[model samples]
Target chain A: MGKVVLVTGAARELGVRFVRRVQREPDVDRVVAVDAVEPVRGLGAASFVRADIRQPSIGTVLAEHAVDTVVHLDAQGAGPEGRAAGRAFAKEINVIGAMQLLGACQKAPAVRRLVIKSTTGVYGSAPRDPTVFDEQTVPGALPASGFAKDAVEVEGYVRGFARRRPDVAVTVLRFAQILGPARESPLAACFAQPVLPTALGHDPRLQFVHDDDAVEALRLAAGEPRAGTVKAGTFNIAGAGVLLLSQCARRLGLLTVPVPLPALRWGGGVLRRAGALELSAEQLRLLTHGRVVSTVRAREVLGFTPRRSTQETLAAFARERGAGPLPPGLLGGAVDRAAAVLAGARVRPPHRQEAERND
Target chain B: MTDAKVIPFGDDEGRPRAASTDRGARPRHRPSAGGRDPRRGGPPLSSVPEQRSEADALPPGRDAEQQGPGRQETGRQEPGQGGLLGRVLGDAWDARAARGLAFLRRRLTGEYEVDEFGYDEELTDQVLMSLLRPVYEKYFRVEVRGLEHIPSAGAALVVANHSGTLPLDGLMLQVAVHDHHPAQRRLRLLGADLVFSLPVVNEVARKAGHTLACAEDAQALLTRGEVVGVMPEGFKGLGKPFADRYRLQRFGRGGFVATALRTGAPIVPCSIVGAEEIYPMVGNSRTLARLFGLPYFPLTPTFPWLGALGAVPLPTKWTIQFGEPLATDAYAPEAAEDPMLMFQLTDQVRETIQHTLYKLLVRRRSVFF
Candidate 1:
């Protein structure tokens, strides 16, 4: 018989893709998709459990379902709502919820593999040059208040559990920038907005992993049978190449305004002084030093390959609902600007409308 | 012979002393080079014999002298009698003839002896030091106005400017003291938390004896009367990009000065040159970095592995110059409490290093080492 998998936050982008990929895999017989909200669409052959994963009783419900591979991915404080909710909420959900899920997995004797989605925020803001962060680099100083509290609490629980339960294989994938469909990530929103120019050009390089690859990473985590602290064991799930924000903005048809580092430093200073941007003095240090992650271990241990390029991935995303004309920044040349207009022709609004009428 | 002079680089004043006829480190009149008579060179304790006699006994099975002193001797017959390549070929011929004789003696039953690569110190030091000099000359080269500022003896804190660039400045400083300074004292550098955590790298670093650049480690090393190095900027200075390279990052409330003030070690301001040009981080992606729990995205030329890991670090030349020591011994025990004094001292050290680096840059005629 194939193994059953339970995924919390099934509605979220990473969790949704996880369910889809698992269901397609021959080894996975069923995926028990859990979420706070009901699934808008059904996952074939997979059971859907709508419940808040943070609650204590959620574990009993998961145990009753006979989940064998519990891929826990429920949490909040990810998006804009993250800042509004006080520090305690971040700890309660990202941390407490994770602990509760692990408890549930332990209760369910059938649950063999527990895969937790971890963020690279644990590495903190130290400058490490040419040093590949593998399953060794510990989380440096906490940069921001929210990230500091959440990353610590989650790692602490997972680490403590790994020691006690050597039988249950636990994999914590510290993922880099995640990008895919249905991602209302702040960047995606930024892309959708009619910003003429992106601030601070040539300041930071970004790596984004497509949603499919993100799911593949989760699947790999489920298959692995190892019991160790795994340290950061982080991977740069970013898209195949690194690109500047100006380049991305130019490609996305947004304004490519270049805010030099000096100006930003001055502006940041003023903003901090004026209480416009709330960042600690230490946090500001990280703003100037660029962050880079190595995905070497992911290929070695997880057998993951990111198929989508940043350009293709962004193009597909730009086709999402109400994502009309390409932004001005993306209109690099006159020829490309014309091509972008033509690219919008593939939007297929008529086909959608026809399908809606048929339904 | 008169004692050899100990001159700090950028010390323009003429001083009289004996010059070394050999390449080896010569002794100076000042007693601080561990009070070992200037007449004697290296450690007085003879290096454990080339081959520990079997009958003389062993320390332990694992401690069977894993490669350092004995192995190097057996491996290389001093090169330049006919140069490195000529010696290798000559050795290979001898091995070949010996193998043929052994083959006949064993009636062709014996296995062939495998040749393994061994460490060549003189060659390695020459290559590594030459490769590192350019990086040192560009950013760290400083002018020492007074050679006498650094005491002839005891521990000293080399406080200097800190910049962003992954503590390349710190490493360059350590190499400078070893390679260029007259004393050739091995500067024990204190590293940040991130550096010690990396794999493969962590192994090489531990062998080099780098501990966390924490106050405890610095104090401990200094208390042993050894030179301890630190960069007050911590993460802040290291993270800065090329545009902000020389600009000193915040000193993190001057804890390093406090450490020096308490220890009574003179603070030696060290200026590092050429570290900034190694890699240029052009852009950062905060949104994406946050997803992965990282600080910011770095868009340097070789990184993001534009194909292979070899593209990681550009072999930039390094030059590090140590400045006149900032004396903290005269201060009262509670002197660390004076923030104004600490601030002034930090600025002075930073300015000195910065000025020295600019002067060094002017002296450097080329970009690549």
Candidate 2:
């Protein structure tokens, strides 16, 4: 009999894509999609179960479907909203949601495979990180706050669940900052801006994985039972090579404004208030000293390699941002002028909706 | 070295491979005789491919042609020049501002790429090294001996005596290896965390391929066949008092020896004289340095009293000598695990450098000569 697969976070583009991909597999019989909200559009022949994993009712939904495999992707890109209510709401959806889901997965004897879409952000960005973190580098600094903290908490709960259910083959994919068309990340938001704010005088190394590569890795992780020994391994997924923050901006035709670290702290507060930057203070460490994770295990064991290089992933974002018409050379001149204005004189760049000036 | 050949250059143009040098790092315009290889007398064009050692043949980020409308090419008169004032303006722009703008533009527009380790060959060559060139050649008048000790290819650990209050010796040694070595191989130096803690210094150090002084980083470089330089003395060597100038400090626990053994790279003992005399630290200001978040506040003879000029190093005649390559390849890889073997090799390398430094100092007639 074909296994019945239940995928969480069906509303997300990644979830929506995964459900469709998994449904096409001959080995997978039934695809049950679960989330708080229904996907705006149809997700193939998969049944959509409207339920929040944060609530205990998600267990009833899982039992009804007899989920043989659970693919958790809800918290992949959860950002803590600026307000306390929003933060609490995000936590409920992410941390509490994962707790509820894992509790259900532990009880469900039929669920033989569990795939959690985690991020490399749990490793945290710091001044003294290993040049590249492989599968085993202890996160030097665990994220103190924000959605990233939620990820760490979720992983901790997942680990707890793994110990309880040794029968279930668990695969935690720690994907690098995903960048591509249709994906939304703090990095993408920064690149989308005409003037990219960066840590002044620092060109921190950056790594990225394309949205497509992330989906492919997820599919590979999901197709485990039919293949080799279904071992539980936390895999770090990323494209090859890395780019400096400045280089990323340059490729996108976005102007880089290097703000002093102190001023940037202040600016970050202001940005949070204005709702200009979707990312939190902790995310700033990413721009200050960017993080890179190795895909060695993922490549060798999982049999996955990202088709896009970091530069190519970034270029996809640039292409999505519509970097044309101004011409690259002229764009460079404009970047210098903007930087000179910011660094030399305290030019209060109309940073929010600042593009209205051209109109 | 007479095998001159032009590299087949199409595949490496736009695609970022890995940089050996950048167009930004064009060798300075110096007159050369006909048929002489002008650029720093680097390895023959035939050897260039092998010497660069970048597995992927990525050329330095070449400046893309971005000839904007309304801006004429800076040089060469385009027939009808708009008389005297326009001619002067054009001449002035072409002579000075154009080159400066182009350089800045190239930098801003990503014409120079940094490696995964953060080494920017262009920045190291064009900006940092250019600033230090005059000081290397003229101010210090650095006399390099035993360049033959450095291997023309493959990995070698340069275990050098680290001295001088500000550690100018590291940059000088980098220049020494690049300019004097037959292959013009780059030196990847392992740096202490204190250097990386500073603002601009951290970025520049990374650009120059000076990563955190750790075994993981060092081994990775060695395995890649990079010439890795390590100053085992670290802070102690740089912070020593003027009285103990030539006395080499303790090479810490011989981490470098283990690294060499593991990677099977020969250790080249390097002794640098005259660096100790520059900015002589007569006393240490521990409290003040603590306030500054510095390892040691150097109380140089000319410093604190003479302001910024006090920070200026005295023009001392310098000598850097490289001793014979101590082969770690002879030992089995397991030797790296043996603390006893590592200690013996570390002490031997330290002693060789110290002896070389003493000999060089005693032969010197004058400090400033």
Candidate 3:
């Protein structure tokens, strides 16, 4: 029962939340929060270790603390800086940091469990994907670059390490586009704007998991080994059902700027420069034929049942982000939001599950 | 890095029929979206970001109580619900405050659900198929020969010969199956990448449950016991000159037979008599076809000359005949692997359909009878 948990990327809110969450477990003897930068948020009683996980120093920190479990959250999306730096920085931290952390976990005898947050982007959105992707659905097209590619590489390392450490329980949670009150996912950030860009012909379906569910899933994956609990495997954590891009844009009081595919690539760069969007090639692929993850494995293997559905999670994020602090000049964003709602398209809402008698 | 080629394009060669079918199937959806369907081949209009009142775009008839799943069903808002002034004032207050009501207002008002395959059944039935009903039932006057052959329930593979220069037969089959089946079953048509590659056609095809013509998708649907329709001839049967109508091009590796054997679902051979006469592809321009990214550009008597009016199909007095189900339940699931059996079964289904087409064509029935 003496669990010493070390959490990486503890400077971020999601990382901080994991640190605090692990600390509350009665069996967890100590919680070590490590990050390259000092955390601005309060960490309660958890000890803070300031070291970049990419450095070999992180291995020493793991050994010294006798970390029995390592929750890796350092892999993340791009930063606020220009597109080039943001992508480069994210790659270094996500791939390199993950490799170093896995190395440390491999050497540390005390580490029994490793839960690293991953994404469904590893599946790679394509026009020809299997209708539903279980964990085993061979990723149709591997991610080329951006956070998606980073996650793919990170997962590759994690899988490699799992083969070496037969004693360690390595769990990978491939989360769908996360959305919540202040849960800054790349997709969420896209919605943070008053206007959303979409591929002209496609209204791809989307899936989301709430922040609270993410926290719970992380904790469950690292929970003290139980007799009948979910075993170690890659699981997809997503809310049930999906929402269309048009529906999302309308719900957030935003105007959908339908851009043709040919012009979209150039437009993404222009918007990225103007501070209007985060238009990565990966994100654009997602926008064109949005990804949907099967939550069946997440439920059966990871023992998770999210409290919020995709619509609810997106609605909450839309609500919170729509109310975010903006300059007086951008108040017009609110009016446009309401007007889009008032003039929403004539598309009919889906038949309620109970009412879908044909199925 | 998630690279550029996610292999978004489906490589299923036989999925060629839906390009014509969906293009034909699209008349139901165009007028509703204010003509924004990118497949209509208009200039991609970049929505101008000008100083227009947001109110002009706000959707009407949305209120707080309608926040639940079936918000659109009940036409009237709650009795105590206020009007546009209340919403604008609430929105105004939301604008000033950090935690404004804007989020709640939008969140609670409208929510649309789409399935895993990106299909919106509510949209398909209410808007799409309904729009095509008059044209399908009246315009073509499509007659059915064997509605009784379709199983009222359970998974069955309905394999048909793909035809019509524009493949309007697929939609007619979908409508025929949907309208005439005793249990009111729907045919989940498997389309090729060509259909998904088009602009508006892709969106409508998906909503209408036309996915990639692949084994994985077909198996998943069959496992769930849903009826699946496949045009085994693909583009060869559809794009063949009118002279080759009903000849039944080789059914590519007998994929449908293998699919049926693997799933143990019965196979129903379907034949259409009049689709070959619809567009009447007398000739095709190779250069024009390459330019338009289409397999071939048809030179119909009226098309390219009549423009939009020429796009309309002639009332060919169509006839669809569904034959007896060829049982695959006798084969082991592993039987899908045997090439000899698959080849024999494929030829059997092909011969049955071809013979039936001849029989139907000769039934003292003229093209417009």
* TM-scores for all predictions: 0.44, 0.82, 0.79
lDDT of 1 by residue, A284-359 (tens): 3333232345566666555566777555566566555243355432222443444344344334366653554446
Candidate 1 docks with a DockQ of 0.01
For model 2, residues A94-146, the per-residue Cα lDDT tens digits are 88889999998877778889999888888887766666777788866888877
Off by over 4 Å in 1: A79-91, A126-132, A196-202, A224-236, A256-290, A309-331, A334-359, B1-369
Q: Which digits, one per residue and each the tens of the lDDT, describe model 1 over residues B1-369?
A: 112223444332353222232112223212233222232443322322322242134335312221111111111123333222213322222232233233232212111111001112232233333345434443333222333344546787776555434566666665556554555555666666555444334323433445566665567566767677788777666667768877777777777887888899998877665556666766666786688655555667666658557234564444556677778899997988899988987777777777887877788666544
Q: Model 3, range A229-322, lDDT digits (tens) per residue?
A: 6658899999988887777776676767888987988888887888677667788888887788788877766678899998889778766775
Q: Which one wins by lDDT: 1 or 2?
A: 2
- Stretches of model 3 off by over 4 angstroms after superposition: A80-85, A323-359, B1-109
Candidate 2 docks at the CAPRI level of incorrect
lDDT of 1: 0.54
How many Å off is the CA of A298 in candidate 1? 0.8
The RMSD (Cα, Å) of candidate 1 is 23.2
Which residue pairs come into collision in candidate 2?
A: B17-B58, B18-B58
Candidate 2 lDDT score relative to the true structure: 0.74
Distance (Å) between predicted and true CA of A315, model 1?
5.1
> Pick by DockQ: which candidate is best?
2
lDDT of 3: 0.74
**Model 2 segments beyond 4 Å from truth?**
A76-85, A225-231, A324-359, B1-106
